[model samples]
Target: MAMQGLLPFLAMVIVQLGYTGMNTTSKLAMDYSNMKPLVLVAYRQIFATFVMIPFAYFLERKTRPKITMSVLFQIFLCSVTGITGNQVLFFVGLQKSSLTIATALTNILPAVTFLLAVISRQESVGIKRITGQAKVIGTLLCVGGAMFLTFYNGPIINIGESKIHWKYASNSGDHSSHHQSNSVLGSLIVIASTISWAVWYIIQAKVSDQFPAPYTSTLLMCFMGSIQCAVIGVCVNHHKSDWSLNSPIRLVASLYAGIVCTALAVFLTSWTIQRKGALYVSIFSPLLLILVAIVGWAILHEKIYVGTIVGSVLIVMGLYAVLWGKDKETKMKTEGISVVMPLEMVEGSKDLELQLPKDSGSNKELIANVEENGTIKSNEDEEKNLGLS
Candidate 1:
């Protein structure tokens, strides 16, 4: 039981680590090898599609539902927004921005998704409830933090020098107006990517309901994204040299992003979501910010600023506030179900007792034995375990 509970936590941690590596390596590929974001995105899509094919084919073969035109269309939309739109904008933004900023900006995804859900009428704010208040406050805090992080640098935090230095580390001393403008633009674009990702989550939730086959749906999304990205990549990057993966770092980056970040991460995320709800999965996102901050400093030798620290704290606090509210709501609903189930059972037992022959020795003994054995009390015990009294 303990292991079962721990597995989801472990899986999510691995997923975050995988994404951190993708960020670091993808940034390295673009900066050092001059790989165009579009081309890299296209390659990553292709690799992910191939990697997911076998899993979708073998694992979901029996359970996979027939793909309707509606489902196919939704998957295409998911491909466009989730993969192509999100990845392209993010990579381009990362090219112009620091790795830490790139990861930090993504913490707003849950807030974005929540806003979208409320707008779409898929979720309710329930402002009268404390849970709803938390959600609202959390969303506001996330937006405020994102804005602050984008606009303010607020002096660098002197955390001493990093012992480990990356060979591909670019000079971080450039504080020119041009560089600052680019960083602002990049941050805005990255925020746009988060919005796109949030849209994907909303659409993907509907897709999951209709399809119910995660691996197969992911495979189809990747396949569609690959084709869409390839056409865009080809048109944008016309030079034959731009398409080449001669550089080992570029090749590794693309492959890692595709296989680990897309394919494996999706698998692990799906598994973790199955075990512990989407809230639980999303709660791990802030950990990515922490990991990226460490990696950006220790490996890439990126400097941390006061704005980064303050903004990150606000974002993380808001994220937890939102998650805690959602979790509390879920527990309330579960407790309601548990409470009603036992009451209904007790009522049904009473009905059974009234219907039975009063003189029937066997039936009387059976009921007495059950009461003595405390079978119905087990339900109460469960409620106790769930903290519902």
Candidate 2:
């Protein structure tokens, strides 16, 4: 394949690697470092803040907004939900459950976020068509996958092992490794975290109305989240020596999560959103599950089973269904089939299009190309209705 065509594939691989790496590293750090959840949350925020503050100061110094109360409150709200709440709950959930379940549960986030937005009247479901029904059903299927991973644990063939490692059967003498049974509770915690994250996105959209500098906004969030989680961590882990920054794994994980995952990931994602739009970036992220499964098999040695395969298929199918529905809606709207008028019609109706300039320059004939009856026609070439009434 040509190098240009390979760029998107490489970008996707990198993104999925980042997701799986974050999941695995977080788990390893938690296990080896034996750190409290809130403390890790504090460290993650502190690391992210430390990394972002300098970048913001250097890059956005000329455009930084004056510190306002509303900005501060927005940052505080963002930090509370997105950073502190999301990370703390995810880490706790990961420690309690299988990484597979944690990853899959998170797959329900887009659907959940969309549904919440719709319910809040921030979004609308205008069409009651087959595509719309498919989208809704697909979202439910994604949720069902999460639920199945959490609740169902029967005799399941280890599909990953069957495909990759046929010789090795027992893992450290533990056989009931359909998944870590802790997945049941962990999935619930992560689900809550996902909701919190979706709410954070909602709040962040509101915050964007106040602050134009994305880097500065994210930096402020990290700072506030660090302080908030630090206080909570200290109180929760009182007199516990394990809460200190003595463990190398915890220190590394905190730094990685903060600097790389939070700081860099957010920056790159924001850049992509700015360039290509948010939906363009989001619709591609579900492929991270394949990476997660591979990481779980290779690093964590978590057994993948029939249910995981089936569930994953459902989740992916659901995500695509939602995307398809959205695309169809957009197409209908574009074709002027919806109640909303197209931009051209709106401009033409208001008599605002092709207004003559006041400078008294010679008028130039204008022509607009429009498609009609399977043919492209210039407005000038079309016959006008000139009969007097």
Candidate 3:
């Protein structure tokens, strides 16, 4: 039982680790091997489609629902937001910003997701309640942290150079106007990617409600994304050389991102979301920040600034605060339902008893009973209106 309980958590950890590897390897490919971001994203989708489709076919063949045009369109939208926009922006951002910075920025996902959910009425927030207040404050803190990290480098805290420094890392201190402009643009692009990702979550929630086949949905999204990205890549860069996979690093980055990050990570996350919820999976995002920071420091010799550290701390704290609030709210609702259920059952029993000839004694008593039942119904209605049902 304990092992079963731990399995999901372990799976999530592995998923984050896979993403961490993707970030590092992708940075290596782009920074050192000069791989174009769009081309890399195009390759990722193509390769991910290849890796996912077979598994989706074999595993979900019997259980998969017939794909309707509506479902297909939803999948296409998901591909646009989640894969094409998200991956392209993220890769471009990663190429411009350091891995640690990109990873840290991803911690804003839960906050962004919460805001989107509330806006869509998929989630409710009661500003009058402590839980809602916490969530609001946490979201603000998370956004503030992201802004701090992006805008303020502060004084760099030297944490002793890596034993084996990457070639690109040795000259990472270049502060040319072009580099600075690229960095700022990349940060904004990455922030936009988070919005796209949040939109994907909302779309995915709707898609899952209709479709419910995680593997098949993932495969279809990858297939659609591959085609779209390929078109975008071709249009953006007509040079055949930009799409070359001759370099080992380029091949490795593409394959790793496709197989590990997209295929495996998506499957694992979907499974975890089924077992737990989206919030549970999202809470683990901060783990990637730590993993990437350490890996970047040691492997890529990325500098760790005080501002980055402070911003990371704030983001992680705010992330937990929001999660804690959400959990508490869920628990309270569950308890409310549990408490109301017994009263409902008792009232139901009373009504059944009142139907007997002997108990049907007084019209006055019946009117009182009707009023009490109306009160209960009104309470239930209020709960539903509050989105706590």
Candidate 4:
């Protein structure tokens, strides 16, 4: 029972871990191997489609619902927004910006998703209510923290450096104006990706409501995404040489992003959303920032700043606030149902009592006979002794 309750949380954590791995390895591949982001995105879609097709076919064949045009269209939109737009922009952004920046920016997801959900009326917003207030405050805090991290790089906190220095650590001395410009551009791109992702979440919730087959939906989405990305990739880069995956890092990054991040993560996220809703899935995104930070510091020799620490604390606090609000709302709803049920049962019992005949002709005659024979039988006694009465 405990494990069943924990499955969604565990699934979200696994999804974040997959994302963390993608962030780290993809950054490495782009930085060192000079791999193009579009190529990576294309490969990821293709590989994810390949991995998901067999599972969707065999596992869900018996249970899958017939695909309608509406479902198909939603799946296409999901492929465009979630996979194609979100991933391509993210990889390009990660390549141009630092990993810390990319990770911090991702903390904005919950806020974006919340706002979109509310606008779509999928999520309720009552400013007078505490739950709504908490969500509002949480959203503000997340956005503030993200902006803080992006714009303010305060004095570096002197955490102990990693012993295992990466080879590319010494090569990152390009702090030129051009590099700064690229970083800002990348940040903007990533922010755009977040908006796209938020829209996708809303659409996906609708899709899941209509068609609850997570693996099948994911397979279809990936298949569509692969075709779309392939076309985009061809248009962006005409040279066949740019599409080469000869580098080991590029190959590993593509495989990991595709298999773990896209195929597995998408399925888990969809299943979790169907179980717990989209906001629940979005709230777990802040975990990626922490994981990416630790991994970046340890493996990539990335420096941690005071601003990063401060901003991360705010983001975590905000995340907790949002989750607390959601939990409290759910608790209140459950309590309401529990309180109402017993009262309803009591009212129903009373109605049954009122509708019951006072006494049948035969029962009244028997009671009268008993009373006439000098048996002390009151009305209450008669009713108690004779169920009909």
Please list the C-alpha lDDT of all candidates, in the order they appear.
0.68, 0.58, 0.66, 0.64
Please give, for residues 49-151, the per-residue lDDT of candidate 1 as tens digits: 7887887789779978899999999988888888888878888888888888878887777678778878886567767879789889988898999998888
RMSD of each: 12.8, 12.3, 12.6, 17.3
How close to the true structure is residue 26 of candidate 4, measured as C-alpha lDDT? 80
TM-score of each: 0.81, 0.76, 0.80, 0.76
**How accurate locally is residue 207 in candidate 1, as Cα lDDT from 0 to 100?**
72
Superposition error at 31 for model 4 (Å): 0.7
Off-target runs (Cα >4 Å) in candidate 3 are 1-10, 166-181, 266-280, 334-389
lDDT by residue for model 2 (130-230), tens: 65576588678878877776677567664544233322212311322433656677779988887887676567655654565556776777788789888
Candidate 2 CA-lDDT value: 0.58
| Model 3, span 129-163: residue lDDT tens | 78778878988989998888888878889778778
Best by TM-score: 1
Instruction: Name model 4 segments beyond 4 Å from true.
Output: 1-16, 168-181, 262-285, 334-389
Q: Comparing candidate 2 with candidate 3, which one achieves the higher TM-score?
A: 3
Candidate structures ordered by lDDT, highest first:
1, 3, 4, 2
What is the total number of backbone clashes in candidate 1?
0
